[model samples]
Target: KLDMRRTLSEAINIQVPYNFERVMYLLSGGQNQTEAMLKMEQTQVITLSKDLHAKLQDWVSTYRVEDSEMLGTVQNLWGCHKYLSDPHTAVGVNAAQKFLHGTQRPCGAVICLATAHACKFEDAIRKALGSKFWDGTVLNDPKLMPPTAGSLQKLPEISRGTFREGEDWTQRLREVIEGRYPEATLVTPHLGTLWFSNQAMAMLLGITTAVCFAAILSKFARRSKR
Candidate 1:
């Protein structure tokens, strides 16, 4: 059985991707010879040069956020800004807020990049906010959900392909990709059409145009100030 404690900290309710832990173990010279680590030994690994590593250590400041803190951040952002944030974005925001209040605070705006739509992390959002909040804002309100979200939820059939341990999983994956798996069934597109419609294209074009216009206006405003 896999050790949950290695990938997830039960005390803080914090979970990290398996590959992340693997890389860290390799870099830190951890000695446990796991199957994953043995396989990684065959592949070429890149390391940062001493000078670049020193420069990064000098410039970058990282802060840790617990699951509870991330959840609190999600709640606070929603309450204060009326903005829904996924847990991943909330973690970054929480860390950014901490840095701002810390001794080495910067004198500029701190932009936290949102990784995904709030709907993608429904469980995290539901946990952060209550069921009542989720019902009111998401379940009952159709307008609150993104257009692509509805379509995604309505997908007719989904399948998972599994490979056993000690098997050549990579070769099996290659066979699947090459359409050699007799049991594998290909899914035809629903409605016999592509997912991206002309409306979506138009909306994307409009957003791009608006961003370009805003950039030009900002440049002019800066020049005027000068």
Candidate 2:
């Protein structure tokens, strides 16, 4: 069960082929959720450092990584970082420490946050991480919540149009078929004659459809004579 929350933004979508967990974090103390929501939206594939990967490997070897409790903690990084106290960096914290086995330095941390729409996920962030300090917390206010029916319907269609425009299957198929038939070579009488002779030879050997008719005719003639 993967929960995908879409934010409404006008940024270019970067679609990648990978599977991972999505951690939805609500930032408290009135911090702008647009940045947090954008961070969530920008996520496609998270690359782990070699050290991080090795640490994960070590943990997997020692503990059963498939344990349900372990998997849940691994999946919700952003949430875990928020609830847990951090002694360093203040603003940025690594939430994957429990599952990860390595000495911690916040090096090689290049985090990018993007969205299809920064505005859409505003409400979700406020609910999860309260907004009392971030510009008077529009989260609980009815005005801040998006109208359910209108924006949801419009987004999918817009996304589909952009996807189709970028890479069209029909056009690619057409090109493939056209390339194969470039010369427009025809099967002339010579080719037809060769095919016909081969078919005739097959028929004589009783390997064609005529064999069934011949057997039926021979049986009928014998019955008539009898």
Candidate 3:
């Protein structure tokens, strides 16, 4: 449950109320994310933190979410409705409502996609509500169990093969370079932060890979002469 994010909470929340009669045993840690992923489900995760927010760009279509506006919307909703909306959902709904108001569009109803459980971002919610969140209906609700503390203590286990920030990404390249051109040097470029420009680095990596192969062939020729 400790590793649980808001998106997963949204899915489970829907599953529970939609089928409350049956016992929905929620799996956590590696069991659900790792094991379930092994089944070949076409899962796509969109995280704004990574600047891979291109996923939501398609969802919003025309609307662009800015820094102050998005958080401002989230906080506004929290203080007003006592509803806790995660950053993703907050940006989305806030954009939609603003657009509709600006256009003066008259419609029967406009549906905004709220993707996460509020309990998942309890701290963020508290901040949004100005640390006066205990008065809110969401975290104070008696019917629901806390997301992190359900019937059991949360596990600190991160999924295997998960990408850690500072790991040696060039380890495999280093191995090849060491075996072939022991004299040659390679520099690992520090990608400052995750953004679309990372794609340009990807193309650069492809070119470096070709250089690696050339070095490997050079080593092979020298060995054959001996």
Candidate 4:
């Protein structure tokens, strides 16, 4: 009983139950930030000094006040409720509840925008929201096609060459052959929908990438020739 209690307490120590600072920080940002928003989310929990309390409070009070449109955008985006969530989502919920009184109708849902993968805050989520709050699908990459028998058949046909020793790919092939392919090989494909646009800005980025890549490749070739 003592050991179990100690373990539970250790778990609870890392879990952020209700952090006013975090809630304040999330709500202080842009009014409406989408999943594609490139802003570096300040997630590191900060314990404010006594002197900074008034300053922080002032910041929160004025946060997005100058940008009412952004405030409305964020509020509208987060108006719904969905049970699946994370800390940032919890912070949003906390904000909406405190400010918006949560959803009004019985049919309303709580839509949560999970800011980070659940594993990063699993202990915290489990402690504060309970373990069942986590669904096994948090980190799943939906972009990847599930392995099919057709894929397996094509794999053998695509590579009939015998595995060579002393190479990582060869070793991986050996593992696959030996039926020992580790879960570490599980790859998550990227969904590259996050993009910043504005035709002029995009053209600049394209030109920049081209110039950089050209310079890099030129240097690589020169080094190889030497």
Candidate 5:
């Protein structure tokens, strides 16, 4: 993978295409290694070199490469499809556009794997598209998340522990290879699309309990009145 860690600020996200172990895990029958080699042989892999990644970063915008690329992608996608894409999806958009342009033939329609809800990166969305759309209308405002919730800086405590920060270079790199900290064990070998950790379950339980308690209180109040 491209080591743009030095070039891009730590805050800026660099979403790469794929990691090898994950690919191997998928190709290797997901559990048994019987079909691994065959599956890998059949699979077509695309790699973006460090140089190419840097070039793409620069090409996306002349100034503030990291920030501009993702921001530009979010704006461009929103303009085209009336949908907001996360940084990861924006990376895919950049790659697809770059790939299609390189092709000589007429590219009919390219597929962009839009991952994650755009509201998750509300701050990024706001920075890219502004407080409102071009028409001065808000996108999913008031009742739901606005273009920016302004909470991007404050990452969830559970999510924050996933990185091995302040560790040695080798250990830090190992953390990436392992791809999970104590908090985010869901990103492990489990192939399921949906993953909810204990913390998530606890939060859900708390919310449910609060609602049930409120309902009980309301019923008791009604009974007293009757």
Candidate 6:
């Protein structure tokens, strides 16, 4: 049920789906013994049932978009809103626009999630916005090229290990981990505190909605009066 194409959407749109078994195989460092041991502990594959799958199909409507459309979306957003969006986010926005304009248009606001920073996908950005603009403006712009990008690029490799076909990868990984940290440390997880109370949040949401509604009503009233 997946389409595999050579597009800007590299992360999600894949040829073969990496299932739980494939993940375990990777985590085991390609060691058959380690993979078997991991499988013994957790072997259950969670797949949606027929009814649930049917219900999901009924609820969700997926739109297929071309690379050209995604690029156009990215360019348009940048030109109009001064917002430089990544290819994946562009895909979502393009899809959302298609859905809104299509025959079965939904009422609610479609929030296209901007998952990653534009700096992360430099090649894609360069393609969307011409190389001339990218080199001249985007390269010098602090907002586009953040300090963290340079910092990340300058980061040294903490640990390195090779997993050869005929070698014991588990032992190799063990050696690497031990070399990095001789003694294992137990760190307690910190829980995040909520900023807003339930009542306060409800009141804020109500106010925002009321303001939006009032604006819409005012716009319509003016149109009718005209």
* Residue 41 alpha-carbon offset, candidate 6, angstroms: 19
lDDT of each: 0.61, 0.33, 0.48, 0.39, 0.51, 0.64
By lDDT, who's the top model here? 6
Shift in Å, residue 73, candidate 2: 17
Q: Which candidate is the best by TM-score?
A: 6
Q: Flag regions of model 6 displaced more than 4 Å.
A: 1-3, 15-54, 107-109, 153-167, 174-226
Residue-pair clashes, model 1: 0
Runs of candidate 3 exceeding 4 Å displacement: 1-60, 103-109, 132-140, 143-226
Give the candidates in order of lDDT, highest first: 6, 1, 5, 3, 4, 2
State the TM-score for model 1. Answer: 0.51
Model 4 local distance difference test score:
0.39
lDDT tens per residue, model 3, 1-226 = 1232233122332311422111111212112222222232333321222222343343324455664566678877766886667766887787687768776442335678878666565555555555555345554564423655433224332222222347665763444334532222223233222221233345556788899999799667755654
Candidate 2 per-residue lDDT, tens place, 1-226, comes to 2343322111111243212221111112232333433344576334554754665554332222222332243224325542211111111222334224545433344342221221243433333344552235333333443466235434432111111224653443344334532211112322221112223333333553477788689667755654
lDDT of 5 by residue, 30-129 (tens): 4432233334445533444475456445433322235677779878887897776776678767767666665433234557776766666555666888
lDDT of 3 at 72: 77
Summarize candidate 4's per-residue lDDT along 29-109 as a digit string, tens digits. 522222112222234334444645664664443111112232333334334432334344455544445445434322234
Question: Candidate 3 deviates by what RMSD?
Answer: 19.2
- Which pairs clash inside model 6? none
Q: For candidate 2, which ten residues in a row score worst on lDDT?
A: 84-93
Off by over 4 Å in 4: 1-59, 62-83, 102-114, 128-226
Which is the winner by TM-score between candidate 2 and candidate 3?
3
* Weakest lDDT window of 10 consecutive positions for candidate 1: 1-10
Question: Would you give me the overall lDDT of model 1?
Answer: 0.61
lDDT of 1 at 21: 39
lDDT of 6 at 33: 32
